[model samples]
Target: MKPFLCAAILSVLPFTASAAPSSSEVVESFIQAYNQHDVGLMVSHTTDNVTWMHVTGKKVKVETSTKAEFGAAMTDYFESLKGANATILDIMESGSYVSTVERVTWDNDGEQLSQCSIGTFRVTEGKLAEFWYFPAHACDELSLKPEVAPEVGVLQQTQY
Candidate 1:
């Protein structure tokens, strides 16, 4: 009977592990929902007390303190941006944290802004518990341009 019980538990373990989405997967799916402008779907991927923070230079401000606030803020943002879009340029996942470099574009009337930004999210139990957005770096900024040496022509950046 002991041997049979152990085998039964072992057989069900894989299915249990597969039941919940990984932390990174949840973050990525939430971003997809954002692109679709589905505020409800976005909130569904976050915890009840989910928090969103914006990092501006030396200051960090809480943009949204709860899931309800997040949904309301997103609704307002979608209306203001009209057709804003975010493209994930790169992403990395470690443990419960997921970080992404994204290109965001939006048009405000006749003015358009395109910027690259870094966002980090902490997910718990397959739901985003909190997220932070770094200050935007314009996509066309000199730092993003390829580096070059005047004498060597093309220069390879060295890693420290």
Candidate 2:
């Protein structure tokens, strides 16, 4: 009876593993798409109704939109920046939630602007269902020095 029960559990283990992409994988794909500035590819990894929340520590701004609306926003943002790129420094996953520390650099009419932030994402069914963004600094820590400070910062509490 013990051996039979062990066999049964072993047989069900594979099926019990989630069919959805791992939280790290989902975040990796999203970051890759973002680095390429491929809005379509980015949106493709999101649910039809995705909720994005930008938390400023003081207030939370929520935007619940369809994939189309999200895609449009991405397009507009890219256009405004001329060209932007993101680098994921670290990624941590817990259950279905993935959190990342990233630095984004953009050309704003030849003046480059770079900022670091923490982004938390909730992935469901292999797609992003929700996201929360928290800026690491209240103001852009701009520097023209040749040596740039490391972007990695301690993860603060998020409104997750």
Candidate 3:
């Protein structure tokens, strides 16, 4: 009888989805691992079939597809650029997606070089599932430039 009563109470109680890492948390952790140059730790934060891409003007490039591939590519990159680093300049969170502007810098021939890119990441089930990167630009150059205002009488003189 007690077992039956307990079961009835449990059935009436509300239940929620298991506690999963938030989209921002997953993306942030991945970047943190990348800054540490820990490929294994970075892979641990991604799905087995993770994907990475770069979306340029009218073109898309697949950078990595599988976890093993990602690890290998990162390993090779880290070897060539030992002290390169990435910093998140801005970020936005929406549902299962996290978008961030990343500032990456490295030294070349005693000169420091930096670039910025926009990346949108999708996290599923507490893991980074996929991501896309916009074209990179020099850090000092804004990806979007300010538009100049049209002349006061230019539009008025023009016909449709």
Candidate 4:
């Protein structure tokens, strides 16, 4: 009976991860908020101490730990979403974490402001704790250039 129960639990466990959102849900939520240009929603899923990293040389460097700081960091990114669009290509899950491959393109008044980004996100505790992004390679000048752009307005942001 004990072995049978264990197998049942294991089989059902994988279904839970598949049925509902899992870590990938957290990332998808964040992207949804970003797509909607909502800053508050983006921060809601994050821990008080969130760590954000970029493929660029820039580092947020934990300066403080507070929701206001987190909100501020989100502000820096959200405000830039004048016409930003985030498209998720794929998601890879590993235990309590998920990696998402995505592309982001921002356009204003028929002119492309930034190129698409080849980005990845890490989710923890059903919240976004760490984010890593790389600029997607583009072919035309109309595309925005990719940079190591990690801008967390809030201070004391930690990496999970």
Off by over 4 Å in 4: 1-20, 57-67, 139-160
Candidate order (TM-score): 3, 1, 2, 4
Q: State the TM-score for model 3.
A: 0.76
> How high is the lDDT of residue 135 in model 3?
90
Clashing residue pairs in candidate 2 are: none
Local distance difference test scores for all models: 0.89, 0.84, 0.90, 0.68
In model 3, residue pairs whose N, Cα or C atoms come closer than 3 Å (at least 3 residues apart or on different chains), thus clashing, are none
lDDT (Cα, 0-100) at 123 in candidate 1? 94
Model 4 residue-pair collision total: 11
What does the lDDT come to for candidate 4?
Answer: 0.68
Q: Tell me the tens digit of each residue's lDDT in model 1 across 15-134.
A: 887767877789889989988999999999999999999999899999999999999999999988877888888788999999998888888778887889899999998899999999
What does candidate 4's lDDT look like per residue over 101-159, in tens digits? 56667777788754445555566657766666654655242343576778777577488
For 35-124, candidate 3 gives per-residue lDDT tens digits of 999999999998999999999999989999999999999999999986789999888999999999999998887888889999999999
Top-lDDT structure, candidate number: 3
Put down candidate 2 lDDT per residue, 41-152, tens digits, no spaces: 9999999999888998699887656788888888888888766888876688999999987888888777988788889999998999999999664224533247667778
